[model samples]
Target: MGEDRREDMLDALHRLAEELGETPTTTEMNDRGEYWASQYQNEFGGWNEALREAGFEPNQVWKVPTDDLLNEIRQLARELNQTPTKEQMDDRGEYYGRSYLKRFGSWNEAVRQAGLEPNQRISQSAFREPPDACRLCGDAPDAGLDFHHWRYGENKAGCYLCRTCHDDVHAGGMRPDNDPGWLMGAVENLIRCHAKYSEETSVPAITSRYNIPSEGLVASAMSNVEM
Candidate 1:
């Protein structure tokens, strides 16, 4: 009975894949996989093993559409209102990143290879000149200057934050410490402080909103915040 159900699901998925004119997105596959797994629990043992036998990998295959097949599918998807799944986007991003690495050597190299503009260099002479007050704390003799990411690269065009606010945000907002209530409080405080004290009039209020940080410097920076 379970085997029969599994076969039915596989057939359905195959049909959907055919209809899409491409490999199903990870989400699509996983949804189907889960349904099949539940329906065929006794025969397949579990979703993971069943999927593995069915030529599905939780990671690699799910990460992106199947290579050239993906590009074709993407073209088709674009014509319709349908958007690619998050996993599909991530997979494609990884693919692009890998391609960038191959053309260059690292992420920085990839950025440079793509002819993206480099970050502006701050001179040592500039560091010696101190601002009147802490950008975040509103205190004088600001202990250090740090860079903060305002909008993560994944979600928006990136921006910077000053050291005090940066540290406060990290210590208060990231995972473990990543409780929404706490982050909201912290971000609100940071924003209020920035609004009241920071010399930069253009600084936007820090709202305690939640978002997943990307997997590099942004992640590290947020992680380093001592909660």
Candidate 2:
């Protein structure tokens, strides 16, 4: 029975992917699918896993540059005069708040990093700086480690992951934001400056000198830098 359900879900996902011309998000699948999104989540341990089994790349947040993400969040907050919620982001942001939550560990943390006052649902949690090796496998590869939100959807820090571990967690998924339109010229300048400053300057100093938004942005820029 379980195997039957899995095959059915995979078939459904394949059909949806074909119709959409891309991998459908859980929300997208729920809105237009025969099966509930949670059903897939439950059966496959995660929506991404289901997508993996179905031969589609799951949604990947890391591909989107953090600076681009923060700018949008800050812009939306300024427009709304308050920190935007996930629902609000859905209505207005170019990227989903789910992506922000996955990347930053929580919506509130992403909001705080946007230089906006979060609603304070939880007290501040310190962010774990990117580590040299994959926290799970402890494999230090030549490629810089990727940050993984171990405590996703919460006010807590996450850990580092190498590409292999990152791919496993993401179910070997492709990033959703493949369009190059979001990479504005200013972003290039910000990353270049951040990469140069990251070598010797502290995050605060880099932010002050470049007028960058927050330490989180600096951290993000540094993380993307080639180690």
Candidate 3:
């Protein structure tokens, strides 16, 4: 009885292959074949094993284009409005998660190739999606990205940032070991505001621009950093 069912599965697989003129995936078989891919797994140990038994080769990842896989990620990102997790890709994406791992060597690499950030979070304000947007200003790469060191000595491209953030780092003489070094930039801007507008006007202008909470603290920061 089991042998008869096995023969039937082989025959169904062969028929499907002939109709398609190439080896079909387990999903394809499930869609078009008389039997489900699960039935083949029950009899033949797995989809690829069943294909080998049926004289057809398993599909190769290289046969698919790199852009094809990356485009799928891009499409999913547009839908979710963020870089998707591996399980999210497996469930909602057209291709298997393993396909990305095999093609790109890592899921993060695949995300990066799609021109997005890996392990993405809604960063600094309501900024979301296309991981290349500035973590501070939330500017897209079209506005220009600058290579930023994560720390004073660790010259790693740790974060994606815009030219404005890049200039702020230097202009404020910030050598932060982490984060965008925003505090010093605030101090510098507030001091500049003091030079242009009176202290009364400067407080509101700098606070509005930097999103500083304590308006009085701007005066204190200016006092300490004033040259």
Candidate 4:
């Protein structure tokens, strides 16, 4: 039954991608698909992986510069008017908390590096506390709650969540590598830059700038500009 369901899902995903003429967003999948997007996320590691299985282009987050990430952290700290807390980051940060930890050893270390006091420290018990209330869904003490990793792997951050929300979070997966919004923004900027550059110059100039010999390669690059 699991194998059959997987096949059905792949077929449905390809059909949707074909209908849309581009990869279907998870929101579109949930709204228009026969299967819930969560199911695909559960079966596959992420929605992008599902799209790959369906022979569609995966929604890959492009490579981001480390300086850009650090700058973003500093900007967030400035906007908050205080050192940003891990929980607050869960709400507002552009990048995952683990990215900071991986870059700076710990959240406090990251904050200190950003020239902010680590006064608003994150505690493990905030993840363990009460063991009754769900942080993600705000369930009452009577409702069951579980500890969930906001980021995976060793020494990662976590939070409390109701059972349903916990399952959803796991099934929904995470972009551990890059921020989805930031990646999309980067893609848009690249497209805009490419379009403007092409509009301002001749194709021969573009080919010369990139040192390409064949017009065929230039055509290929133009065709894949959206990607």
What overall lDDT, based on C-alpha atoms, would model 3 receive against the true structure? Answer: 0.62
lDDT (Cα, 0-100) at 150 in candidate 2: 25
How accurate locally, in lDDT, is each candidate?
0.40, 0.58, 0.62, 0.56
lDDT of model 3 at position 121: 47
Model 4 lDDT per residue over 97-145, tens place: 6456555666656666776645333344334333323433335445556
TM-score of each: 0.25, 0.30, 0.36, 0.29
Candidate structures ordered by TM-score, highest first: 3, 2, 4, 1
Candidate 4 global lDDT: 0.56
Off by over 4 Å in 3: 1-49, 52-55, 58-63, 119-227
Q: Candidate 2 residues 141-192, lDDT tens each?
A: 7878876442336543334557765565444132225433322222233445
Off by over 4 Å in 1: 12-36, 57-227
Question: Any residue pairs clashing in model 4, and if so which?
Answer: none
Which stretch of 10 consecutive residues in model 3 shows the poorest summed lDDT? Answer: 122-131
Q: Give the per-residue lDDT of model 1 (tens digit) for 1-227.
A: 66676677667655544433334554555564335435433556764555555565635443333344335334423543233222232254324333322333433333333333112122222223332223355343335444344343544322234565566656645422366455334444444444455344221112221111333422333343332
Number of the top lDDT candidate: 3
Per model, state how many residue pairs clash: 0, 0, 1, 0
Higher-ranked by TM-score: 1 or 3: 3
Q: What is candidate 2's CA lDDT for residue 196?
A: 41
Q: TM-score for candidate 4, please give it.
A: 0.29
